[model samples]
Target: MKKIKGALALLAVLSLAGCGAGSPSSGTAESSPEGTSGSGAATALEKVEVGVIPIVDVAPIYLGVKEGIFEKEGLDVKLTLAQGGAAIVPAIMSEQMDFGFSNVTSMIVARSKSLPLKMVAPGGSSTGDTKADFASVMTKPDSGIKEIKDLVGKKVAVNTLNNISDSTISEAVKLAGGDYKKVHFVEMGFPDMTAQLAAGNVDAMAAVEPFVTISEADGNVPIFSNYAEPVDDLTVAVYFTSDDYIKKNPETAAKFARAMTESQKFADENPEKAKAVLPDYTSLEPEVIEKLTMPRYYTEVNEASIEKIAEISLDRGLIEKIPDLTALLPSK
Candidate 1:
């Protein structure tokens, strides 16, 4: 996916807007450190760059910035918006980003290839909450596609091929007694999936919020929640960094984890606050943000959920083999 890098660069030029530095590694302004002096003065903060996608699932990261949680933990985080996991992986590998938000499938694939990456924190997860429609398989209302089985011999758009979107949809199709191999998978960006489906360019689309909300508003019908069948309470994505970076900057990594954890707790308790920051990072309107299905943001890494994802990837032949999952986590 070398082409993905160029695509991400173009997308960044067109859509990048936030409180972060213009580039992934451009932020260097530091603040006083964690503790205060006898006179109640704070110490200096360590500056770090984090890469993310402009999706509602990353609201906690933006919330962390707005709430000063990272600053309080002696970290100055610069959040860079990348197109997707394919683009973010290369950035982390090259040290362009200190940490990144990526799906577990990508991380596992990287690890299986011997890339020194480690999961530092949870990005987003599925709690099997029926009321919470974080992701879904959506199609135009008049497409005559009422169920997953109906997708046979049809085109399905996913953000990436052989990733979370494809894996989930494939399992769902199988459970519905449909031939997954008969479904054609098209690679498209999440922001553009709804439009493609609406325009009859693709028969169906696997979408995550706030696009899910957008598509529904545009009269698209959701066949089912994307995470409904395969694995319940799955950890969809995670915050990860390169082992070399972590080895050289252990303290900064820990501070980032602490700050993110605090941000996760705040978001879990105050969904309104999490939703409030979406307008700042994403192009979604305030009305859309208000109605978007927010992902379950957790602080602690779920090894079991990640393992299941790796197993699924192997089963689908996305990865040659499963890597040692524990070795890919941050060292205790």
Candidate 2:
């Protein structure tokens, strides 16, 4: 998969406007500390650079851009595209980007390692309504695979280890009264997994987004869905920045958050708006985009969810220990 990055320096230099203003300018500016809230929402920003992945879940960020929400925030915003959240942390930490959409788990994991990260806003939540967004474990009709437990010793595919795919796999294994260690786990991207399954290379897949919707349409029945299991309220998408950037440019940071929050409002109030604007930033088909699962739009990180994911990470040994949740979230 390709990695995406946005230009932080360029966005810090643009002019600001109100929400849904006019044509947004893309500029570069000197770095400064970002805002906390209220007044900071209207604060001027030199430039606001944001990194985004192509998943339909992050449609709000694109909607904000398409609807001129960020432009109206009295700021100039620049968007950098990337393949996944894994690519975003490094750029933010390196000070190459100002803010990026990410899963709270990634931020928690990074924070546990002292990566100097903070989640400034809530992105969205994957609920029953958004259950179809996940990469799921599906079985062919009458495959006798009644539950995740049935997959014991059977072949299963995941997008990556310890990611949403892996997390879902772990949850399913536990839910089905099976053990993760007993299953044969394979790592493959969503596109490759379907073909691999067709060729009999895999038995099941813990898929995400369009793949899940597509898989169901192809006749595979869902054995279990990650979003429906209530494993963790872990954010699948959020806005994050490195600690250094927060310390250096607080005002700029707050401005970026304000702009993002405005975008989130647009997305929440107008699903069609997201459906209309998301194609510019993602490869999802227009029809597929409209059908994809979209979560409640939030611009702040949920501390409780972050804490829960940290515990899960510790249990799975993805992180050495649970992180101090308070330190990982944006200051109130």
Candidate 3:
């Protein structure tokens, strides 16, 4: 596996557009006061840089940073926003970022290829609503595609090829009684997919929040909730770091995870706070932001949902083999 690190690194290029992460520009934001506690005392709040895409799924982290939730855990959180997993993964590899938020499929692919990575906390989950979810399949209003099965032989735009969008969309079409293998996948970014679909470049798209809401606002219709259509309580993404980071900064890692868990729970229970912070991180309009669907957050990583994803990856030939979940998931 060490000998093939070069080949394995390609897995990092996988996009998180399917998960609705933001554009590919490097922007930084420090939400909490430097080295200050809630009481305004000059206690040291450890500075932490976390690589993340500016998508709806990551609202919890932004909320956590803004609300001083991380500061409550002795962390001064800085969000380093990137467009896709490609940028985040390499940043984590070099210790440029202490941790990253990524779609579970990208992490599974990395672990399967012997890249020493582990999910430290759950970042996001499916809403468990089949009729409505954070991620879905969108088509032009006049496309005549009424259901997932109608997608057969159609060109579907996804954030990246061989990632969650393609896998879950394929499964959805199959469940709809269509020949999943016949579906053609076109690589696209979430930011561009809506326009491309309207321009007739693609028949449909596997879209996530912001886009799902944006597409509908443009008169495009959502035909299926790909994240929920095939699996219940599907785990979409998580926060993670390399084994090297954990080994050198175990305390920091633990603190980050605890803060993240707290943030996720807060976001889930207080959905308004999560939505309120979207403007701070993303460029989406307020109308769209308010209407966008939110993902479920969890303190514990759902091993069952992740295993289902790994199984789909193996069955779809995305990963070489099933990843060792025991080694990949957090011990705590």
RMSD of each: 6.0, 9.1, 7.7
lDDT value for model 1: 0.74
Instruction: Give the per-residue lDDT digits (tens) of candidate 2, residues 88-165.
Output: 678787778888777666676778887878778777665543245343577676667877778887888766666555
Instruction: State the lDDT of candidate 3 residue by residue for 236-321, as single tens digits.
Output: 88999999999998999999998899999999999988999887866556666677788998788888888888988898999989
TM-score of each: 0.86, 0.80, 0.91
lDDT of 1 at 304: 74
Off by over 4 Å in 2: 1-45, 129-135
Whole-structure CA lDDT of model 3: 0.81
- Count of clashes in candidate 1: 5
lDDT of 1 by residue, 34-149 (tens): 65556988765577888887766778888888888887786777777675566778889898889988777888888999998998888777757643668888898889999878
Top-TM-score candidate index: 3
Best by lDDT: 3
Q: State which candidate, 1 or 2, has the greater TM-score.
A: 1
Ranking of models by lDDT: 3, 1, 2
